[model samples]
Target: MTEVVIAGIGQTRVGEFWDLSLRSLGVRAIRAAIKDSGGLQPQALYAGNMLAANLSRQAHVGTLLADFSGLAGIEAEALEAAGASGAAALRQGYLAVASGLVDVALVVGVEKYTDLIGPGVEAALATTTDSDFEAIHGLTPAAQAALLMRRYQHEFGLPADGLAGFVLTAHANGAGNPNAMYRKAITLEAYQKAEMVSDPLNLFDLAPNADGAAALILTRRDRLPRDFPHPVVQVAASASVSDTLGLHNRPEPLWFAAAQASVEQALKKAGLSREQIDLFEYYDAYSIYAALSLEAAGFAARGQGWKLAAEGESGLQGKIPCATMGGLKARGNPGGATGVYQAVEATLQLRGQAGANQIPDARCALIQALGGPASTAVTHVLKRAD
Candidate 1:
């Protein structure tokens, strides 16, 4: 199989863009990605989207986005895996290039979530869960994550103020990120006193829904431009796994077995161990999710994730530098676009373009995306292709 490298990546400023339509957001990222790749256009395109059918009352997003971006006549396919849709689309593009089906491919993930007001948007996101069980029982994503947070806290003896550290760290990192939604540094007092959305999860604990898009251009390693501004970031491995849709049906709710499996597969495929990963960008839809993901991904042992966070060694300048870009907590969650942003950030770190958040000599990074209460997990390992 050919080695697939990330040629370029692009993302719009994540926030509530009430002015931009869904197609416009997609086009913005697509155009930026093409320009970032030195004007290289792909032979095919893959878009990762969730809730376009219900959010916009529209379908055929692949062709629509392709034509809107002035890439008509190219084979465009839509890949959906709930909130992990973006990573799934990138997986397809990786296979296309790795298997020699296409020399170059464009992958974009976008969602216009703000199109629907409060109840409407909530309803659309709930569709990512089990419609017959979880959703019907009024279990919002926050509520589900809250249950996990409670379990995690109880098992690990996490301090009541432990979650405040994650929020504070994310906000501090986000201050340097112009594209992040919440860039101001947050205080522990503010976070602790914030309005309660769920019992264990507060407003500061959840990632806000935003309208944005992100894109990446991938090509075979040998095809990379000689004069490119940055070194190519190779897609070392990509793995996706699914668990029981209903949280109660899973044998263990405290631990995410599917996420663990996906990470193990990805690390094995990359021929690397957790210790080799210089940085990590995992799903942080909620602060507790970050802890759970770190443990499941082998960054920390079970019931010790919050302890690791409390050690002041998990931020951008910390030992592992988890979510140096502020992540979903302060970076804002654009749903489908979130995973693509993770890949883009990893690529930037590998290329030494992450500015203030750049890790010193960072060579290897991991990107993990989770969907619907950890029911679906996708893990990708990327390394500098030097």
Candidate 2:
């Protein structure tokens, strides 16, 4: 099998982009990535998207982006696995390169949630859950997440502010990211005062829906030029897993079994322990999800994940740094584009070009994205190429 390496990465500013169409946002990111890769033409293109059909009335986004971006005849298609669509497309791209089916693959994740706006986006997000068993019962993702948070607190006998640190850390990091939607720093006091979106989850606890696109070019290490401009970031491992979609169907609703399986498999494949990971890019669409992910990924024991944040262990300078680029909280969740955004941010860190969010001597990073309520997890371990 070929060793896949990220050749280039690009992303649009994560925020309300009423001015740009879905295709335009995707094209911008794709063009930027191509330019970043020294203008190399890709043999294939894969677009990851979740809401184009529902929100923008656009489908066949893969061909639309490829043709509009001047790569008309290339093999292209859109892949969707709910919120994990971006990472699913990435998994396809990795297979394409690793199988030697395509020497160069362009993978992009783009989503437009602000086009239709308001409750429609939430309703669309709910489709990722069980339609008859969950969505039809009027359960939004946030409500489900809130249910998990309440259960976590009750099970652990914790206070209401248990997950505040996650939000604070995310906003602090996001303040440094120019492309982040909420760049302002937030404090615990502000968190305490925030309005409650649900009983246990506040406005600060949930990431908002926004418009954005992120793209990256992947190719085998030997296929690159003798002197590639940017530092090479190799795909050390790519693993994915799925669990029960309905929250109530799981044996343990709070335990992210899929996340655990994917992370363990990824770590094993990479021949690296969890301690070797210099940073983590978690799919923290909700603060509760962040804590659950840390627990499921073995960063902390169950019900002890919140302690990592309270003790400054998950901060930028802490033992297991995460959300280094604001994450889904303050960085803004762009639906399917979120997973690719995580990859792009991790690539930047591995390249030592993350500006204010850069980790010193960062050699390896673990990035994971989740579909609906931990129903699907796609995990990847990336390392600085020697």
Candidate 3:
């Protein structure tokens, strides 16, 4: 098998894009990525999207984007796996290149949640859960996260301010990212005073749905042109796992077992330990999710994840720096596009191009994407090609 490497990365600012259509957002990122990769022509294009049909009333999105982007003859398809759709698409691209089936693969994750997209986004998100059992009872993502937050505090004897640091850190880092949606850092007081979306899950605890797209070009390491200017970022490992979709069916509602399993497998495949990761790009769809991810990924002891933030251990100078480019919170969760955004951001760090948010000497990064409250987790470990 060949080694898969990311040769290019691109993204649109995460926010409401009332001016651009879905295809337009995708084309911008795809074109940018192609340009970044020294204009490598992709043999295939894979789209990661969740709400094109439900919200945008458009399907066959892969063909549409490929046609619009002037790659009409390339093999194209769309892959969906809830919020982890982007990672799923990336996984496919990785396999395609690693298996020597495609010389160049383009993976693009895009989502539209504003303007004329209609009011079905929330309903569409609910599809990630067990519709018959969970959505029918109005167990929205926020409410589900609140339940976990409340239980975590009660179980750990924590105060209401436990998650405030997580929000603060994300905002502070996001402030330096021009592409972030919430660029203004928040004070502890503001986090505490923010209106509640769900009890125990205030507005700050959740990442709002936005519109964005991120793209990457993947090819075998040996296939990279000798003249390619940028440093290579190899996909050392890609792993995925799944559990019951409904929170009610989970053995431990607060523990993200899938995240733990997927990340553990990916790390093992990469011949690395948790301590070897220079940084992490976790799915922080909610504050509770961030805490759970930290614990599940072995960044902190169980029930001690929140303490990392409380102790200022989640900052840029902390032991395990996270959310370096705002994460899903301040960077804005652009639905299925979020996973690709994580990849693009991680690539920037690995390439030493993250600007103010860059981690000094960052050589390895672990990126994880969650689907439907940890029901599914896709993890990838990337290493700077030496």
* Alpha-carbon TM-score of each model against the true structure: 0.98, 0.99, 0.98
Which residue runs of candidate 3 sit more than 4 Å off their true CA positions? Answer: 116-119
Write the residue-wise lDDT of candidate 3 on 168-246 in tens digits. Answer: 9999999988899999899999988999888989999999799999999999877777898888899999998998988
| Residue-wise C-alpha lDDT for candidate 1, range 1-386, written one tens digit per residue | 79999987989999999899889999999999988988877989999888888898878888889999999999998888877888888898899999998988999999888778878878788888888888899888888888888887787787777877777888888887888998899888898889888888899989888888999999998888778887889999999999988788977797888899999999999999988999999888888988888889887888877766678678877877887888888888888878898999889899998998888889999998888777889999999979
TM-score of 1: 0.98
Per lDDT, the best of the predicted structures is 2
The lDDT for every candidate, in the order shown, is 0.87, 0.92, 0.90
lDDT of 3: 0.90
Tell me how far the alpha carbon of residue 206 in candidate 2 is from the true structure, in angstroms, after superposition: 0.4
Per-candidate clash tally: 0, 0, 0
The ten-residue window of minimal lDDT in model 2 covers 222-231
Instruction: Give the root-mean-square deviation of each candidate in angstroms.
Output: 1.1, 0.9, 1.1
* Candidate order, lDDT descending: 2, 3, 1
Clashing pairs in 2: none
